[model samples]
Target chain A: MSAPLVIIAVAIAVAFVLALWSRAHKRMDLEQWAVAGRGFGALFVFLLLAGEIYTTFTFLGGSGWAYGTGGPAAYILAYGAVAYVLSYFLLPPIWRYAKARNLLSQPDFFTAQFDSRLLGALVAIVGVIALVPYLQSQMTGLGLIVQMASYGRLPEAWAIAIAMLVLALYVTLSGVHGTAWTAVLKDLAILAVVVAVGILLPARVGGLHAMFTSIAHLRPGFLQLGAKGMGVPWFISTVALTGLGFYMWPHAFGAVYTAKNERVFRRNATFLPLYQLILLFVFFAGFAAILIVPGLKNSNLALLAAVEHVFPAWAVGVIGGAGVLTAMVPGSLMLMTAGTLVAENLYRPLRPNAGAGEVQTVARVVVWLVAAVTFLFSIHSNAAIVALLLMGYNFVTQFFPSVFLCVWRRAWVTLPGAACGILVGVLLVAYFALTDHTIVAGLNSGFIALAANFVVTLLVSAATRSWDMRRTALRAADIPVHRAGEYDA
Target chain B: MSIRALALIPVLCIFVGVVFANRTYPIVLGMPFLFFYMVVCIVFTSLVMAIVYACDPANRKEE
Candidate 1:
């Protein structure tokens, strides 16, 4: 019933075969399954990153958000541009360690940076937990698209159930290569749909003038810069959460770190913003739909409504197919990252000498396990993945305070300082997010949490005064001096 | 120039163009000028990418 069983079957079948082929042929060992053997170059990395960015959130949720929030919807495009530029400054140092140490997760970087395995594990645990809601969000989105594609013939829960089964089977079989190949098709389809709609939607809206006049008449604030209903504080804080939180996604870090060279990454870091062409068009399409579907409640379906209004059934099918593939591609990548982090950082540490082949097998096994549980979670009627993602933002960001002040800034810094910083950061974020929040509206709770973290680090550092930043940070980065394994710190 | 001014130019350009189109014309191509500005943002983003890739020494390598 969901996605015209034929369409769902076709998509599921294609995703499954692709995953199996990659697992059988492309995956040679743990590195290949986890990081595609560190061989992604210009086109490959571009496509993979493309798949990463265009999620179900973009396909269905972008227009939906706009339709739902009106003026505030511009945040999608607004934050995206900001996120990439901000990450440019942040990603290089991360890449340096990932390359040298074969790091597979963000927690790995934290461990290597501070020379504290416990700190590394804390980040790893928080990241994995945070991803649970994100994964569920993707599942919910997949269900919505599948239902839309089915022409609303299937109920939402059933649609979600079917898509989950197919996604789970395909991802478990294929590994990262499976996701990359499918992403190429996924990205191509998204571009074609976005470009076609971008040119057509404005025409259907009775010219841009009428649309503007209407927005002014009915939803004046839709044109407002402040987006007062949500306010500047929420927007700025949400954008900060997205910008900083994006690079911290262990999946993205793992993928970018797997790039062939710093040049490719820097190119990607700067150039990937170029690919945001479709996102810009999407923001427009979301705005366009507002005039036509004034009574519509769901903002996520604005793109679909815009498509149905401007185009016909067959074209709509193609767009729906693109949405499903978007989920499959990135959802698979998340699984790969989650699996690798579990197997390599958490599992391998316990076993230490597990063979590459065994580690690879463990990663594959974990993928199936994680996918199954996430699918079950997705079937529920009212789970909050978006909020959970913000929660993840709070948790993952705890690393930043210690990262900036304690670990990289000085050598011989006491581990207690770093631990206290992370602890306070997490506690402040938790208190602000859940309890009688302290930080006033404009600033995000995460920012407040970070402030707490930074303050704690300074206090502890002053108390210790026993560490030298230069000596420790250099050693933490593992820059080879005279010997391969010898470290100065 | 201050960093603030350097950042303000492009942001201001976006606002000016968006305001001009919204006030002056009908939505062309089923979109308003602000919608079109988004396209401009996307294209401008690409141009920025091309420049960075071409100029950044870190991006180029010996074959």
Candidate 2:
């Protein structure tokens, strides 16, 4: 067998073993299946969190940006590091609330906190919309990885279909425990294979200084934070959008609730920035690409080209396999998180008596449905790395103002305000994305929309004082839960 | 699980960067030296994670 296929087969085998070992059968139990029985210690929490952060995009796309856009790609570093810090400040109280109320999903927190299922439904709807594209991005990357690594033996369509089906099966069969356990191996595999191969590339090439001067001479503006025509406007817009939007992702917030302690959340936030070394590496890959592989029609393949060049066949196969795994685990997590919102927040509420078995059955159905629809949607996409990222970040941040106000400020807003906030936010993003009118010189859409959302929500909320959901949530936070061992560890 | 483990990712990134920064190639696949260095960083990231797991106390518990 070719090295890529062999490496993949081994990874698949490891997934199977881990699924069986982590108690796939027992995962049908609500807590065990959905949230790993809420018993992850510091280590499991760390890995699970890391697995969620690391993705195929981080591998392929980050490099693409660094290569194509040069130093501006470092915006990823600025945002990622900022996100961890924000998540730290934003996540702890969320944990205290969720553990107290036995909440599993983001919508669960909203509905329970505000006693309004409509708000829950609104967040769920936005979440499903945002997450579907994310999962598709994962599958799309997986498809590319397979086709490239196999030297086109596996076509993109067949690769995506088969890889996604396996993801669906494992998620359906094993649930959260399976995701968490498989994540450990998947993440570790990526970390190991990428590092080993990364080191070998520069040695084969002339060396670091040679790579730098070539890029500097070829495009003098590339290394400058702002190209002359572009200047600070583009960089500021990107940083502003991503900095606020990253924490608003549902899977990330779900992790907040999964933390064993407030300190764990803080530790995770503080420490998470340090894992961003790969962003720097990815940025470097782009610079290195400037020298050796001067022009490829598709810049997305920079990392793959690097692998094929620097490593032997077997090692190349392993790296290729690792890239696909990077896609799969994140794809599974996105699929699972999307499904959880549908089943727990939507279906379970409408049918309160649905048994654990019924819930499992519904979650399974939702996964396949999301996968199928997303596969269709991703068919025509050729968004640049920065563009796809900007789209995802802006779309998810629509929920933030509503979420933050409901939890923290005791300022209950009107349904009109919430509705308008989402509507205005979507319209602004759409106008910017579709019309190319987003050129405010130094401002991004998220900053504009966030400012508008806060303004509208505040005005409408002040107008309708009695619907104030904040005080009610505040009253609810003081109610204590029965303590179990390692509760808030 | 120590800060040292996390710290290694940046240290190694800088090291890989120094290597790529020192390269003489003009443009590989339409990307710059910085771009080329990114893939190397990811591999560096993966390697650090793998060794970290092997040493992790809790990984043994799971096994």
Candidate 3:
């Protein structure tokens, strides 16, 4: 076997063994499998959240955008820092509510807050639909990394298939606990690879100044936004939308639920932006690639192509291993989150009397199912990885208004209002995305949809405000809404 | 300004100012000046977040 293949093999093997060993002696119940029993400290939570944040998106998409859009790639850096600020205030209330209410998933939070299983089911469906593209994109990145790492010997299809099977096995066996342990290794490898490639490539072509000077000469205004089409309005809107949607992902909620205390999350939010600086390295790699490896049809190939060109066999293997881990770590988390949604929210609500064990069993089965389906999509789908991810974020961001209302003390939003808001938001997203319009001069379609969602939710709530008029009184009366479909108080 | 409100400074400076300013000259540390300004904003953000954490009652509570 080639060095790249051998190194990749050893990395995957180590990840699996570490994942298994994380839960070797401990018994895992549904809670353990889902949220690691909500016992992770600040460091673990930081690592886990960081792991999920800097996925194939940062490893591949950051560089890809730096190569393709140039100035617009700055949104990636801006959004995370803004999101960390948002999260400082956002996640503590969420973590408190989830911990108090024993909510395992994002859908569970919706179900409990809104007192509607159908709403939970709707959330599950929307989340899974949104996440499939994300999962598929990860698989696509993995395939590309593997194919390039093996010097074109290993087929992309087989590489993705192998990754899918391995990911499914570990997720089924170790759950979130195992994923957390592997995150440490995955993060270390990512940091090393990104630093090496980000710095080395720039240094190769007469250093950073000479490289950008050359790029400016080659494609004038490539380094600045609005030069080639990344308008200011679009950049601001995309950054803001992405910042707001950062913590809306289902897996983000799951990771939040795993925090040991509210302080863990608050502390994490404070420091998470520093972690984002790693993408600066990734952006550097792309800037370097622009000058070094020109005329690549697929911008996504920028980083890997540059790696293959610059590094030796061993370094390529290690870098490829890191790239593959980037794919698998987040890919596995997405699969686990989507599967849990399927079994716990979608299936269980239909059969309200299903046991916890049954949900766990079904969730395990659904992990494999989700991975297989996404693997198929990755092989067959024509969507770019970045586009797929942005599409997912667009769909998921509609939940923001509902969540913002739910987490706050006022329970004014009726189930019908929330549902209608989501429907309108999703439809707007579809309209803009399908029509391929810029949503009125460079604003993100999702941002527009989100605003419409908020407006509709408020209007619908005002129109039907009397429906849940006594919700506050009902809560004050300490009545459980489960006793009655309407107002238990 | 309070630390919480001060946090918005980084967001505003990076997203709004940097985009509109759009200066490309004077590449600092091998990065475009605009991009380098973003890096400065990032470091400033971290420093601000540290202050936010230190001031937060929840983070200050003795375990």
lDDT of each: 0.63, 0.65, 0.79
Worst 10 residues of 3 chain A by lDDT: A28-37
Q: Residue-wise lDDT of candidate 3 within A1-489, one digit each (tens)?
A: 889889988888888887777777564332243345366555654544444456888889889889887877877877888888888888989988898988888888877877677888888888887898788878888888778866878776887787788778868766745455577678767876787888899999888889888888888777887854567787788777788888889988777887777876667666778777778888989989987888888788889999888888898899988888888888888888887889978887666678989988898888888888888877766565677788888889999898888766345577777888988988888888779764456677788999999999888987877766665456657555444433221
Candidate 2 i-RMS (Å)? 8.4
Judged by lDDT, which candidate is best?
3
lDDT at A457, model 3? 88
- Candidate 3 residue-wise lDDT at A223: 80
Model 1, residue A326: C-alpha shift (Å): 0.6
Scored by TM-score, the top model is 3
Tens-place lDDT per residue, model 1, A356-466, is 989988888887787778877777545333444556677776666555443246543456677778778877776776684533565557767776777887788667654
DockQ computed for model 1 against the true two-chain complex using alpha carbons: 0.29
Candidate 2 at A158: error in angstroms?
A: 3.0
Report clashes for each candidate as comma-separated counts.
Answer: 20, 65, 0
Error of 1 at A184 (Å): 1.3
lDDT (Cα, 0-100) at A119 in candidate 1: 65
Candidate 3 residue runs with Cα over 4 Å from true position? A27-53, A408-412, A437-440, A470-489, B1-3, B56-63
What overall lDDT, based on C-alpha atoms, would model 2 receive against the true structure? 0.65
Q: List A-chain TM-scores for all predictions.
A: 0.81, 0.85, 0.89
Candidate number with the higher TM-score (1 or 3): 3
Clashes of 1: 20
